[model samples]
Target: MSPRVKGAVLGLSAAALFGLSAPVAKLLLPSSTPLVLASLLYLGGGLGLAGLEALRRLRGSGASGREARLGRKDVPLLLGVILCGGVLGPVLMLVGLQRLSGVTSSLLLNLEGPFTILLALLVFGEHLGRAGALAAGFVMAGTAVLGFQEGELHGDVLGVLSIAGACLAWAVDNNLTQRLSLKDPLALVRTKALGSGVCTLVLAWLTGQPFPAAQVLGGALVLGFASYGLSIVLDAYALRLLGAAREAAYFATAPFVGALVAVPLLGERLRPLDLLAGALMAAGVVLLLRERHGHMHTHAALEHEHLHVHDAHHPHAHPPGTDPTEPHSHPHRHEPVTHEHPHVSDLHHRHKH
Candidate 1:
């Protein structure tokens, strides 16, 4: 399949899985404090992915040499991802969820897309076209409408700020993860989940948060495995293929999914403003999805390793006895070339517009 198609599928799938998290988490909240629940959620995702990794290794299906492995140089970025995404993001989200309706909280999550895109463009050297800029504006406008209702903000102001803060933290995490997208995604996410999970778990214990009941714990773990674990792996792959800004555009759909699910699951009413916000955000995502960018660009010669098939980008000849029919990774060189094709800000296509 085409890289863009695969990236869109991955991003959408990630959205569906993660979209269920907010409402379900709200239902689980009554039984556990935000800190303790956040810890369990991360621990669940980490442990679940770890088991899958172990199973893959046992079955000899591991990508031992088929994908690039993270190295010392990736440590700082990985740490940033864990700190922002796994720890700060989840904690703040849960705290906000406590004081807000599930649907509103879900809709409010639309902010993450704009925040991520802004970071991608301004700080991470990614580019955005006219459609992308308009899409961002629409999304921000939707958030503003939801944020200020009936001539004032809805729900608790503190809760709104907390969720926005979570979005910002995850925005930073998204960009950092994009930088590390060249590594084995499963391995990268596993390390991130486990590391952040442990840190949050420690913080929960220190704060005297009680452990949840067995049933609640189990539910949380399962949810985390699907939402945080698998969803994250898919998102990492999308980032590699589509760049952070485009991936965020697709992922922005997640909040709408969550909002819709919340109406039935949480018995929440969809106020007119909620519907209005949803319409605006949905329009923005549609624009982003329809947008395309392609131009004549140059690729600098470089050496790197990542899972790849010998295609337009990698026309280099391999050594004798190398497996030629499957995607594999090793240190390789790219001879400089200039060409024109439709592309986003992927690793190879980061040239200035």
Candidate 2:
């Protein structure tokens, strides 16, 4: 399959894995302390990915330079991202999970998408046109309905606040990661896992949390590897192939998936209103994906047409100055004839048919 298709599949799979974490974690909570669970989960994810990177390095004889190295210049931003996304984000989420009901937590978690989109627009100058605005509205409205239906409005304000903070931190991480040029995806994930995991473990110890049992530790390890390590790698790949906006659209489906999974796993009941809201959310996602695919198709077609016409007209140019690989020059310009002269003099050319 094409890279784009592979990316979308990976992204959707990551969403599915993330969706499973909520309910599975709810089960594991009874058997394990939250801080210990959080520490082990993150540590496992970090170590698992690090191991994979080490194996790759050994097999390739250290020739794979795609791994990103953390430089002093990247220290501050990296620390901030890890502090917010890696350390604070999961801790808040785990705390919220312990206090809030599964359904309530899932609904509240939907806040991440809008927070991300708003941050992208305001901070990164990422455009969200009329269609994107409509998509955002649908998602927000659906989430609000779900939240109200779940009786999250009656829950502890502090718990809600904690989850909200987690969402915001994730939003910041998503945008900030986009700014850095990390050649090695594995290295980036490893760095985030190690930094965030270590910080969380330190904080947990400082807070006087008890150590986990062997079974609890084992569960946490599995959870961390799947939810943190693999899911993030898939998410990064998806973002790289599909761009942030489109990947965010796909990622928005996770809450709904979580809600669905909760029914069997957590014994959560869905009301009629919940079903309606879910349908609306699904519709919004479908519309956004279709719109993105259409846009990509048109862009690729335009580029193909332009290149085809340029090549047909400049068939005999030398490999250097007038090479077809170079951009076409202005047709109206007066210049002496040489191999370097404009071959396809159509700088302002428009492709037709």
Whole-model lDDT per candidate: 0.82, 0.64
Model 1 clash pairs are none
Candidate 1 regions exceeding 4 Å error are 62-65, 88-111, 143-166
Give the per-residue lDDT digits (tens) of candidate 1, residues 30-116. 767767776777778889999988887778673443688898989999989989987888778877888777666766766787899
Which is the leading candidate under lDDT? 1
Per-residue lDDT for 108 in model 1? 76
Q: What's the TM for model 1?
A: 0.87
The local lDDT score (0 to 100) that residue 17 gets in candidate 2 is 77
Deviation (Å) of 346 in candidate 1: 1.1
> Model 2 residue 291 lDDT?
42
Q: State the local distance difference test value for candidate 2.
A: 0.64
